[model samples]
Target: MDWNCKNYHTLDFELKKYFGEKAIKLSINGGFTCPNRDGSINTCGCIFCSEKGSGDFAGNVDNSINNQINEQIKFLSNKWKSNTYIAYFQSFTNTYDSVINLEKKYTQALNCPNIKGLAIATRPDCINENIAKLLSSYNDRTYLWVELGLQTIHKNSSDFIRRGYDLDVFNNAISMLKKYNIRVVVHLILGLPNESNHDILESVQYVCTKGIWGIKLHLLHVLKNTDLANYYYENNMKLYTQEEYINLVCDCIEIMPQDVVIHRLTGDGKRSELIAPEWSLHKLKVLSAIDIELRKRNSYQGLKFNQEQK
Candidate 1:
């Protein structure tokens, strides 16, 4: 797909077309905690998740939703000249609480000026019929999409990561979300412990067959204060080099369906906390490398897509 002249379909490219301009994501913390971290399921969250639940960039939870939105808008104004935003519930499990409380936080964001849409990120286990219906209602009114952190589909890798859910759970979550016509975005992390390139590609293929609206391919980062960091040092773990990651990202893009929006190929971790994959700190260079590699091979996203599986 020639999205904004890029090789793959991008969320930013699609949003630009929909909004007729740039519509940035305003990451907000909803003061929610994952079931895995609240002692209900397991006290230690997913092995790789950070102290902030992988949302180091999210707004402060102490502030009201509106205040957080306003503050972020003011802070972002200096960099982006956009007037619209998508309220992104990024911290922890956004849908873990009571439905009533969830609506309050979501409504508060939507009520704010220039909030063009909503994006909620949570684990598959947090979703149910009630949550699905709630999200569907918002989808009918405004731009909305739910992101499920199904980091890997393989049982061994999932267990090692302490994800606390199974493939069946993720399947059910997708079914419920799709039943209500709500768009779904699935997250997958590459370079997990003991996973091979083939294993990562299999997970990519598995997600593509689900007909999800979007996908986020994350480069695994071992950040400080997390179990993964300890594992890295003690075991002398091998993280992907910049070239290896760039090539692997391009490999993933080749199998992805043309219509599936790529929300992220890679992202930066909190600088001070990141322990491995130091090359990831140069985000722009990594991104450029992916594009350049794709061009060199005269290939683009979906060039090797096997649509029959879907």
Candidate 2:
């Protein structure tokens, strides 16, 4: 049977191939803090980041890890009805802590019922040999993936966003994780403050050079109370329309390797917090548009991928 997303390597298809069934990522807030927000790197978080630390949909930080997992499972059961789960530490910098504390929290999630894998979302600068070794220890027991946020490869945009770390940090983190044979997923955002379409594709090209497992493509949406919101009103920043975003995403997929899983095509921003690009709140509508555009162009993922460039 032909898959719905025949062109792109969707994460759903990849998971089914490995797990032999559908698996859902249950987001858990590990009550973690980012180095940029804690004065270790900078006092202010990313300009577009929300107060929730990007864990807007994750479980309550006040809840115990076990409790959060159980409750989220029950809540999501109606939607997924799948028993297999990936414990996703989706909040702040998940690896910015002691190895002992990290192990304790990660072990608790892995031990939870129905959790077959662990996905830790973190900053590249936070990773080290000790943390890499600790995360590697889990590889023998369960499926483990490390997610790093590399919003853009452009230093200008990176500085504008106050990412707080250079591209070298991301390269080093990937090297450490690769040594342990751990899968790495990178997150990239389109329509950043000054990034052009060429810049966005350049970022995708850069990812191909890095041996990573997956990529999440996000649209830059302005949210209330964040620096981005203020920047938008004050500077009249441009936001991508739904049609523009769909076209750009399809283009990105075409330039990427077929084996690099498309972890996400767009982000589900909390409607109440979203301030710009109102169309982003219609996630399903936007996704459908991407499919329609892909079919219209007869495009499939990696159609333009250049192995020589890698």
Q: Residue 89 lDDT in model 2?
A: 98
Candidate 1 lDDT, 1-310, residue by residue in tens = 4587788899999899899999999999999999999998899999999999989999999999999999999999999999889999999999999999999999999999999999999999999999889998899999999999998989999999999989999999999999998889999999998999999999999999998999999999999999998899999998988888888999999998898999999965978888878888888888888989999999998999987978
lDDT of all predictions, in order shown? Answer: 0.93, 0.91
TM accuracy, model 2: 0.98
Residue 31 in candidate 1 has what lDDT?
A: 94
Model 1, position 289: C-alpha lDDT score: 88
Off by over 4 Å in 1: none
Task: Report the poorest 10 consecutive residues by lDDT, candidate 2.
Answer: 1-10
Model 2 segments more than 4 A misplaced = 1-5
What is candidate 2's lDDT per residue for 1-310, written digit by digit as tens? 2345466888899999989999999899998899989999888899989998988899999999999999999988888878899999999999989999999999999999999999999999999999999999998789999999999999999999999999999999999999999999999999997789999999999987898899999999888889988999999998988878899999998898888988999866899888888889888888788888888998888889888876
**Candidate maximizing lDDT:** 1
Q: Candidate 1: lDDT over CA atoms?
A: 0.93
